[model samples]
Target: MQQLFKNYINTFRGLSKEIWWLALITLINRAGTMVIPFLSLYLKEDLHFTVSHVGWVMSAFGLGSVAGSWLGGKLTDMFGFYKIMIWSLLATGFLFIALQFINTFESICIGIFIVMMVADAFRPAMFVALNAYSKPENKIRSLTLIRLAINLGFSAGPAIGGLIITGLGYAGLFWVDGLTCIIATLVMINVLHPKKAKVLDEIKNEYPISAYKDGTFLIFLLAMALFGIVFLQYFSTITIYYKDIHSLSELQIGLILGLNGLLIFIFEMPLIKWLENTTYTKLKLMLFGVVLTGLSLLVLNLTSWSGILIAGMILMTIGEMIAFPFSNAFAVERAQKGNQGEYMALYSISFSIAHIFGHNAGLQMTYKFGFDITWYLVALVAFVCAIILYFLNKKLKTITN
Candidate 1:
């Protein structure tokens, strides 16, 4: 056991200090991620928006995310990751504050769109920064470390957010979230300057054609997008399910959802390390992750028992551990040296597309078809995604080998 623990630590030993600070920045930013988790609930409950209306607003956020991701990637390649990230973080802070004051449906929709656009632009820039800071060999482990930080903060965020919402209501959530962004931005500006100052100049001249022209990668994107649609339900429709169907309070729902992040935090790093030694390829593990995600949703519908709910959540978290980081590493591997931002941006766009399907379609389906059928539909989607990913991986492996 001691040796195993030591080996796990060794996996992280080669990574640079910048990677560690990046993880810290991620943790600080995510720790205040209270607003999005409960956005549907707030819109439905406080603003008296219908479920469909909530879905529309959320989809608007998704649309903005798509635009933001594409623009962020281009901007990162042009202006560099540092300025892009700093502006994204600070702009997101201001938007969050602005969102609190918007109560009308049209106004809130516009607010959500702008907020998401500004906030989500940070993602591609962050990934680009990660690529610049870490060595190629340490890439996967570095991404895992950052995800570990994210999940750890996620574990805390919603729990604290739940308490805040219960005591002070939704406005408090926005204020706290906004303040955290500012703090993260301050840290980035004052303490953590870029180690790879030449990254901008290095990649500036090596422009490639559009990612859409790459057929294999496009297929991979489609498969991953389907997986993302299913994976994102935990954020979108599941909250409503717990509230309406299970009659759980916000605090209980937050705690239950927080369990996913807690499990990921505890197990993901060690699991990634273990997988490194095993014969299983990253794609195979990701396939298993997708299958587990389907099973997680299926498991939830099997019974109304609380234990079953927790069990399903555990399975979903395990799926996340297996799939999400590896999928990212795969994208990074696929990119040409100078075009990492564009590839990562395309990957980000896939998840943004998922928000459209996962939120609008999910909520609409639940409203019309009920949770059982909706969940089964999502499960079937995951199963199909796994199959597609399997073939795609084999193709890539053959090409590389």
Candidate 2:
């Protein structure tokens, strides 16, 4: 056990101190990420909206994410990540608090949209910061470390969110969520501010708009969009599945989701570290991950037993651990130094587009066809996407090499 623990520490040993601080910031921010995971439930249970209305609310959040990612990238390139990161954190915090007052359907949709827009804007800047602080060989592990922090924080968020919901209601969830965002913003102000400023200056020194023109990247973006649509269902559609189909309460839903984070936190970093030494290409690893994702979703159709949900969640989390960091690494490696923000922004947008279509469309399909058929369809989409990504990765290697 001691040696195993030592190996895990060794996996993360050599990253720059700034990278650690960045991971800390991610931890603090995501620790309060209570609102979104439960937002669909909140809208349904508290606001008494139908499942279709819940889809629209999630889709609205996705739309804001799209705008924020685009605008954040442009601003990060122009002004540097430091200023953009700080403001985004502060704004998202305030917006979470604002969501409590919105009671009407239209009002709720607009509020959720604005909050996601402001909150998601933080992503591109954070990616840029990761790139700036880490060495080339360490990039994937650095991303893994950050992801581990996020998972750890997320593990806490939902479990605690469940308790808060039981005791203080949904409004209390927002206050705590917002307060953590503000706390993270202060950490950025005091701890990460001065050190990351030089990295931001370096980012600003080169500015290229060619990420839009890269054909390989465009195909990669498409693949990401498809995968995101499948993966994000866990966030939007699956919560509904748990509540409506399985008849679980909000606290039960939180525990199940929290299980996903707990598994990732325990396994992701070590797995990625081990992968670093393997002969596997990034695409191969990604293909494996995507396949697991399809299997995870398809398993639901095979069984109605709630215990099977754990199996499905495990598969999904494993797939995430394998796929997401490598995908980010591929983008970073392919991007020109001056345009990291732009490339990362486009990458962020893929998930946002998923948000736009995945939930709204997913719910509509489920409402029409039922969960079994809907999940089967999602599995099929994953299968097709994996095939495309496999070929595209081969083609990209030929082009780049």
Candidate 3:
């Protein structure tokens, strides 16, 4: 037990102070993530929007994300990540507040699009910042640490968000969300001064390639986008499923969703650390994670029992833990061989594209055919992507040899 505890604790050693501050900033920012998880519910229950309307609004959010990510990445390369992060946070904070006032379907769609455009720009900039703050050797663990903070915040956010909705209504969620973004920006400004933070020496490639021209990396991104589509459903349509199908309360739903974050908080670091020491390739682990994620969806169809919900959540969380950090590390590694900003931007864009399709597709399928069919379809997509990734891995090895 003592040795086991030591191994777990050792996972956190050797990270720079800037990485810690970045993690703290992420935690503060994500803790206020009350709005997105409950956005579908808010639109449906509060504004009386139809399911299809909710899908369109969410797609608008995704479209905005793609634009934001691309812009942020481009700007980060030009102006640096510090300015981009600050501006993105401040703009998004104000937009969240503004979004609360727009009630009409068309107006709300535009509002959400604008809000997400400003907000998601933070993602690529944050990745660039991660590259700057962390040592090359510590990159994956650093990513995992940041992810831990995010999950920790997510664990708290939904439960607290549910309570806020209960007491202060959906309006309160926006206020809190806006305020948190502002506060996180303040923390970033105060602590993470650009001059003080140690920027790592860049690893130069013999022949730097444009992210756009890299055929192998592009295939990897396509697989990632598909995996993202499967993963993101837990945040969007799945919430409605818990409520409409299982008749779970808002608080219950929030707690259940929060469980994903909580489990990642406890288990992910140790798991990543352990996986790092294994002979298995990162691609293989990613493929295994994809398989688990697909099975998580398939498990939903096997029974209507509420117990299955926990089982499915556990499967998905484990899959997420295994897949996301490694995928992030892979993107960062690829970015180092080219224009870091552009490479990371394209990586963020892939997931943004997933957001574009995942929520609307899941919601539409559930609305028309039923939840069972949606699950089957998404699960099948994930498995197919896993196969693609498997082949992509083999192709990468052939090139290396």
Candidate 4:
């Protein structure tokens, strides 16, 4: 037992202090991620929006994310990750607070779009910062460490957010979300001083090419976007499904969502560590993970029993744990071939595109057809994407060999 505990601890051993600080900042920021998880609920219940209106608003959120990711990537490449990270966080803090004041349908859509634009800009810049702070060998583990912080915060956010909604209402969610961004910004400024950090020289590829010109990478991004679409349903229509179909309370829903994060927190790092030592290719692992994710959605259709909800969540969480970090590492590896900022931006933007379409499609399908149909459709998408990724992996290997 003691040896097992030590082995788990050793997985985190080689990461740099700056990476730890970055993880801490991510923890602080993500811990207050209360609003998005509950945004559909808030719109439907508090604002009394129709299902269609909710879909439109969520789509707007995705549109903003795409714009933000593009702008952030460009800016980070031009200006440097440190400046972009600081400004994005600071701006996002203010925007979240401002979002509370806008109540109408059009205004709220505009509000969410603006807020996400500023917020998601942080993503690519943070990735660049990870590149700067981490040693070459430690990049994947550093990414995993940051993801662990994110999951930990996610676990806490929903449970606390549910309580906050119960006590202080949805308005409280905005305030908490806003304040945490500000606090995270302050911590970043204080701890991760730009002057003290070590920025590694960009990896020089033998035949460097623009990320735009990379055909294989673009295909990979498409698969990522599809994965994002399937994964993001957890934040959107699935919440509504739990509420309307299963008749779960807000707290129960929050706890269930929190369970996804808690499981990732407990298992993901050690799992990644174990996988790192194995002979399995990252692409092969990702394919397996994607298959698991599809199964997770399919599991939901198997039974109406609430016990199945836990079963589905477990499958989805495991899939996420396996897929996301490796996918991130793959993107980073690709980014090193040319412009890191541009490549990473496109990677983030793929998910942004997913956000734009995924939520609306899920909601509209649920409204028109039903949750079961929506699950089947999304599961099909996941399975199809997995097949594409499999082919892409083979092509990549051929090129390398």
Candidate 5:
């Protein structure tokens, strides 16, 4: 036991101080993301809102994300990462705390908009910093460590949130999340704040935020948009599906959902090293992941048992872990030096755009067609995404090469 523990630390010894700090921040941020798992529960049980109302509120977060990505990129180009990140952290923390008092959807909408914009702005800055700090060979490793930290927090957050919700209810989850954000804000402020000299270099002479003009970068963004639209079902409708359709127990649901993050934590390092050499084909994994995710849902329709559904979810999780790290790495590598935030922001924008239509459409399908039909519809979208990705990957490869 002692030998294994020492070896584990030795393996990760290659990680830089900055990457370690980023990893720590990743943990904090993911703990914040845990609130989403219980968001619907909170809205319906605590806020006394309808399912549709919850949808609208969640959609508002997506809108904020859209604004955040564009504005964050612009600000990173103008003001620098440290300032944007520090402000973003404090703003999100305050928003989480403020949710303690909001009464209506309209108020919640405005609050979430501010929270997401600030939180998302910091997200791309962290990505930019990670990319800048990596030493060529360690890019994927750095990404995987970041992913692992996040998944760890994600795994813990939901289980803890679920328990808190069960015991003290939604407001309890909010207080805990608010506290997590406060600490995360402080951590980012102290540990990861970038130097002022570096800020001047990025901001001086006023570089155009025309990061959208980079053709390969644009193609990468679109590919990921399609990928995200396909991937979100794992979180959105699927959570509801497990409860309403499969009649899964809360503990079982936690286990099934938690498996994804656990596997990612265990497998990410080895997988990153193996995939280190892959380039434009990075998108191919995403294509396959979507297919696998769609296929899992398809298989779920054929099974009424909780065990089978759990198995299918495990498969979908594997696909996600495989796909996302590659997609993120591709976006970072394609950007010019000093413009990583803009590039990552551009990459993130694809997902934000996909969400605008994906969830609304998904809710409609779930209501009108039943869980099985929703699965089929999600499958079709994933299939289309896979085909488009394959075609675009070839074009991107030719252009990039």
Candidate 6:
């Protein structure tokens, strides 16, 4: 136990000091997000909305995320991450808090969407700004640490959210989640400032993000959108599969999903070390993830064993860890120095698009097709994603090298 504890501390120590702030910020953000994982549940269970109405709410959130994705980079570039962040926290917090009062399905759906867009707008800004500030030597390490914080919060958030819902009910959970964001904003106010790094100047001095405008960035975004379609299926449709087919509880689902993020927390850095200095190879590695993910989905339909599901989740996590970092590294690596925020913002759009399809259309498709068909469809999507990346990899390699 002592040896294990020591090793754990040292793993974190391997990251740059800047990551400590990221870890803290991620925790605060995740804490604020306590409302997120259980949001669909809140809508269905508390507000008693029809499934279609729930879909609209999810759509609204996705729309907001899209807006944020487009604007986040420019805001970071213009106003700086600090100022925009301030606005994002307050906006999201109020939106979350406001949801507590709505009894109507339409109001809940439309209102939350607007709130989500406003709140989520701050996300990429934080990501890009921190990426801009950190030393290049630690880019992968820093990103890994950030992902770790997000997972840690993710791991904890649902369990806590459920507990709050159980005890104080959904409104209580919403209020708490909102407060958490408000607090994170306060801490962030100190972490970023009114005046700070001149991102444009830094780009000129170091790895220029602008150099990536050669079109590889657009290709990367295309692949990301495709991959995201497959990835988002986990949240939107998989839950129904577990509950309807396997009779799994919310706790069980949380544990299953948490496994993916947990594996990433443990192995992401070492994996990156093994793949060192080659973001282009991420395309191929992500294909392996695609297969594992496909396998994971298959396991759910093919078997009824609880242990088997857990095992499949572990494999899926490995695939996620493998693919996500490489994708991020490739995009950032190819970006022009000054345009890191813009690039990250553009990449974020893929996930937003994915979420939109995943929750809305993906859910409808899953409901109609069933798991056997859904898993197969998901696998086909993964294969297509791999194919797209393969062609992009060929071109990206030439440009990068």
lDDT of 4 by residue, 1-401 (tens): 99988888999998888999999999999999889899999999999999999999999999999999999999998999999999999899989988988899999999999999999999999999998778898888999999999999999999999999999999999999999999999999999888898775346567657899999889999999999999999999988999999999889999999999899888999999889999877888898899889899899999999999999999999999999999999999889888888999999999999999999999999999999999999999999889988998898789889
Q: Identify the runs in model 1 with alpha carbons over 4 angstroms from their true place.
A: 1-8, 195-209
TM-score of each: 0.95, 0.96, 0.98, 0.98, 0.90, 0.89
Give the lowest summed-lDDT range of ten residues in model 3: 200-209
Clashes of 6: 10
Writing each residue's lDDT as its tens digit, candidate 5 over 1-401 gives: 79966655554767667778878977987876766766655666578876677667767777888889878877876776667777777777777777768869899878777777777787677776776566666777788889899888878777776677668766776777777878887987787656522221122224634566777667667767766766776666777777777776555556666777887777666666655556536777777777787787788877687777767867787777777888777776666543666777887778877766566566657777777887787788778878877887888779768
List ranges where model 4 is wrong by over 4 Å: 200-208
Q: Cα lDDT of all candidates, in order?
A: 0.86, 0.87, 0.92, 0.92, 0.72, 0.70
Candidate with better TM-score, 1 vs 5: 1
Candidate 5 lDDT (Cα, whole model)? 0.72
Where does candidate 3 clash, by residue pair?
Answer: none
Query: What is the number of residue pairs that collide in model 2?
Result: 0
After the best TM-score superposition of candidate 2, give how far the Cα of residue 379 lies from its true spot, in angstroms: 0.5
lDDT of 3: 0.92
Q: Which residue pairs collide in model 2, if any?
A: none
**Collision pairs in model 1:** none
**lDDT of model 6, residue 68:** 75
lDDT of 1: 0.86
Q: What lDDT tens digits, residue by residue, belong to model 6 across residues 57-173?
A: 777767777877778767876776677778888777777888788778677667766776777678677676656655666666667677778877777776676567667877787
Q: How displaced is residue 180 in candidate 4, in Å?
A: 0.2
Q: Which run of 10 residues does model 2 get worst, by summed lDDT?
A: 196-205
In model 3, the runs with Cα more than 4 Å from the true position are 203-207
Span of ten consecutive residues with least summed lDDT in model 1: 196-205
Q: Candidate 6, overall lDDT? A: 0.70
TM-score for candidate 6, residues paired by index: 0.89
